[model samples]
Target: MHQVIASPQGDKFIIARPGTRKGMQIPRAMHHELSSAVANGRDVPGWLVNAGREAWGLELSGQPARGNVLVRPVTPLNYSRATWEINKGCNFNCEHCYLAERAFEGLPRDEKDRLLSMLRDAGVLWLQFTGGEPTIDRDFPHSYRQAFILGMLVEILTNGSRLHRPEIIELLSAMPPHKVTVSLYGASPESFDSLTRKPGAFKLLTKGLKAAKEANVPLELALIVTKHNAHEVQAMREIADEYATTYTEYANISPTYDGNPQPLAAQAPGFLDKSSVFKGCPAGHTFFHVDPHGFATMCKVGRENPIGLMTEGLDGLLRLPAIADAQMLRSGGCSGCQLSATCRVCRPLAKAYQEAKAPLNTYCQHDNGDETA
Candidate 1:
């Protein structure tokens, strides 16, 4: 079975399995015990077993657990990759956006520079610049340039509407990101604009993509499958094929960051049918998201508990108790559910449903109305 174990000191976690050569990094505080147990490949310590149960919902039989525990483990002292949302303000109001019309003031130029410097100091090797729209941020080029100069591989996630601007193309052509992901909403302008509620957005996105292609920036196309544009998914795929860019698709539409299910209506019918069993999330582990306000959370799906970057710094914030606490799964009837084999629902969304008894139809693979679970 595929599984992972939490760090003994409670900062990082690792995927532990038999026949694998990786395990948790020896915590300085519990070096002897952890090191011995990990080396023997005999048994996991009681605290680690209990932490696995509590933090990750791991069902450990009363036996000596042995195997490669840490698969691509993260060093508690630093993270090599990060997803930074430079600005929360977005021009489009896509119906299925996880962020509910995100709007926020951006960090000043000096503050952005400081954050960029801190990221480089923390040993970030790849920085993904994202936003409501990253290119829309006036301070983006400065930060992107700085990250590139620091020798970090930079990437951008945008809707491709702003790439058509001459200045935008010039900046990108000068120092292209490692990759540019343009989310395609619809195959046609009418369908795309109807879904985005922004007239001429599809045209702008196409023009921007053409410009980016001419500039020779590595590009990718992602399709957001929704009820409004589900029919256009294949057409969008064909468009991406024509562009010779990497193509991907996501049918699931999650609740907003605020736990509001307003965008749930746009979810395509039978989207959950394709989901497989719940494995685990990488939150508080190898990956984390930093919002516009410098608050770090596991991911953008749920922003329930956040650590302030200014106060804690990336290392300190990630090590904070809240980061691990957020990973803890509420029982909420999922522990012994019969559908665990094909259940794709995650703990964060389940927690939201548990607290409010809200119905999240998007994750209901079996179509039952029991919201308490």
Candidate 2:
């Protein structure tokens, strides 16, 4: 089990325990004292208890409190789960991929090992291994095994092209990723291969799904809605249901992380007019995205401003003023706009702000027909 302590001043600490990851935030002055007590297994001082009670209604005791020494049901820094794009290169070039073609360039093996060590030490509880395609990386096995051995819940996001191979399934069954999610492009070979631009990829994907089911790998399926496959979304869901796997759908198509607009034109109908705004986005505050070159950003699409993971380390990167002050980026015109209620794009997903001072045309649609500046 892993325990995390987040200070009100934006510092995070990971403490080991039996089970459950606990998080708390206190003032900077009290952080050192509380962390010292946690590390030494000593009772929290009187001052610390008073501060905890006033600030966050924290309950603490020398004896076990509901199986944990310190009890904090929540914290501001919810930095437990993270998505690491180990490699950017994918075997197939899907038409609607958010990543550009250059995304296939991956970091050197040694750099990958170093980053894994940093994440483990930082108390990352769940690691989602994503990429242009993670299986395409040769060093993926080594990195996956390292995280698994560290007691971290490992997840893999793949297209399921290589999963049919006996050796691939064997490795998955042996170590066993916590979750294996495969992206479904289309229901049939024609629709699937047309989108992936890879001949016979649909057959390979289905074969991999079958192999995964036979090998007892925990499986899930997701449908990515594109103009090419919008009509077949229901058929794809039925296929997933037949496999007895969890299914989900996402209709929104994003511009490339590197600011390419090529895929923007391929978005399905109602993709843009479907404006919805999630009140709070946890990207920089609680979650972060790491690119192939060890660059850590608030989110995958917000790569314009990045913190170098290799040079600064996780702790240092998280403490930066830029990351700590994470909040939704809204325009003056958007404040009074009626469409704000249904705007689905978050700050990081708004490439307009990250690139040039422009409003996201896709997210500016208003049912009331009010013009936004």
Candidate 3:
């Protein structure tokens, strides 16, 4: 595996490690030189060796550019980021899961290889592998290694259940991810097991966390606060602090991606923080999401007008920007809302809430006398 990935992102050129955030912005001239050297099968440049040493403490001197450093080719597509749901499967049954049904299903190995290539061709420099729990998938190791081989910075969104497995740890240790984000259900075993509906969930999670930390895997914790574990928020923070890992809190729960309202029952009433104002996002334009079977959507939430990568391929993505625009328009219950100017929910998310017949107070700001929110 290449120690570093050198790729072009729009007008910028960056050299970054596969596992860590450490990177350096190189000038156009330097980028061109590196690209030419890789294309021509030349040795690593002296300047890059010195620079890598300075930036990431890497020793690249006397190494061949062909295998030691991966130089990604520029592509016609302008997309920079993407998220692929490896499979909608999980070991734990969290009540607050956004996926209504966790099914263990995805494309075959060859089809997945094709999809990753298409993503690379689409200029996706950063790729996130997510799932109901990505690590549980049998093809995860192959997919992860393939993404890294293609010179894309890979990030894993997992529950950390399988991190303790010897093969999983060994694979991660060999080809480090840009980051491994683990969701913390609860701090204590009782609360954690209860929330997940799995008796030994907490013990397994703790074991995985320790193993991943010992293996020096880059990790970030997502503290998923629900009614069942809201009381343990401080203890959760303490656990994160104990590991000296960065963490973010997720208190507000949403309905399932397919507009199912079951997950909303688990929302901690006191912890439902107001969402940030919905500024315009570059979902389909700069970034997109793909489901397990390779159907690409504008984002994870807006599952409308999916383009099946298995049949349609990269050309199908050309329609995404327009699809995204159509989906973002204020429609249905949100049409002509006076409060849309200040509303926090985007049109697609608002539509999901509408489909679920969620309480207006949960997502809408319109009062009873207003225009039928």
Candidate 4:
């Protein structure tokens, strides 16, 4: 007979020729079974046994559980802006690229298609497509159309390089992504290229922005505070007011920038991370970061590592060994912050953490005689 055996952790099942120990290990969602067991007196083994009966064509003695355990209960927030990296490689040579190692060219077409289905299955109703520059990908337009058909509200983050082309502009204006956020590196070529380290990038972005404005598409601007553009703060703010909604600012906290000499903190851009939303670590209550290579962690930057890609889906990811570690770190990162009440969760910070090693070497340098603003 074909059947499976459960582990004490309730995360894995060994599928064997009934009763054999040597079986293919499979990931199991523990929410309902574990919850039911805890609800019915911690008889986890019994609960799983019953769960197996139903999964493997056996008769359950009582009512069966419905729905996946890993999925959080549905609510209005399900569609609230989920971010996805559409492409990994970047065009610019910034001094502080956190994902410098992982950042490569675009994902394969088939990989993109698979990821779309995966996101949809994960209850992702809205997608914020970020990249080195999403506009650089040739399939981005088609990707946009596909996401739209899946009932997703799509957003894009681009350097605005390819957007100057009429074809790109026309599609964006016609369909209109839910939002388009552009990174305005500098006020002019001299200022922009100084930071991006790529001559002509500033001009390319400006051309793209102007076309976007002419296309009648809503455009927003972002700026990262770096040694190259700190003095442009006021100018950036004024420029933001010119045509964009708000200036979404970030600091110089990429992997390459950590532990390095930088301008004063007062010279850095103002920003917030999610921890500002709660009193302490919000690991369990709040969301966690899913790294580009696929690992789940507590605060994205902390040392805890609970789970990993044990299978083909996220169901397996939630059950990894590092989750608890991440959770503890998540709790600690939030619980002890001196400015917890005033702080906010910053994805870029988490992005840096997930993409680089800790002591993070960048923002966490609270000890340096140089904790600028």
- Supply candidate 2's per-residue lDDT for 95: 84
Clashing pairs in model 3, backbone N/Cα/C closer than 3 A: none
| CA-RMSD of model 2 | 8.1
For lDDT, candidate 1 versus 2, the one ahead is: 1
Scored by lDDT, model 1 comes in at 0.68
C-alpha lDDT of residue 225 in model 4: 60
- Candidates' C-alpha lDDT: 0.68, 0.67, 0.87, 0.52
How well is each residue in 45-162 modelled by candidate 2, as lDDT tens digits? 6754554455445555443222223322223344666789988888888887887554667678888888876766655556889998898888888888777655466788999999
User: What's the TM for model 1?
Assistant: 0.74
Candidate rank order under lDDT:
3, 1, 2, 4
Candidate 3, superposed: residue stretches over 4 Å from native: 365-373
Report residue 363 deviation for candidate 3 (angstroms). Answer: 3.0
Q: Would you list the rank order by TM-score, best first?
A: 3, 2, 1, 4
Count clashes in each candidate, considering only residues at least 3 apart in sequence or on different chains. Answer: 2, 9, 0, 20
Error of 2 at 150 (Å): 1.6
Q: Give the top-scoring candidate (TM-score).
A: 3
Could you tell which candidate, 3 or 4, scores higher by TM-score?
3
The TM-scores of all predictions, comma-separated, are 0.74, 0.74, 0.95, 0.60
Give the better candidate number (2 or 4) by TM-score.
2
| Worst 10 contiguous positions by lDDT, candidate 1 | 13-22
Each candidate's root-mean-square deviation in Å? 12.7, 8.1, 1.9, 14.6
Give per-residue CA lDDT, model 3, range 1-373, as digits (tens): 6888788888888898888888998887888898888889888899999988998899988888888888777777768999999999999998888886789999999899999999999989899999888988889999998998898999889878888999999998888888898889899988898889898998898998899989999889999998889899999999887653599998877898789998888888767666777888888999999999999999999999899988988889999999999999988888877777777778888888889988876666444535465
Query: For model 4, what is the alpha-carbon lDDT of residue 104?
Result: 63
**What is the C-alpha lDDT profile of model 4 across 1-373, one tens digit per residue?**
1122222122233332221113244454544354454355443344545555655554434432222111222332122234555666778866555443436654567666666655555545446777656666667788777765554556787777777898888777655566788887767677789777798998888788778777776778887666567777678777778767556877644442222222222233443222224235444223343434444344334424434422356565334334533444433333445643343344334333434443333344333322221
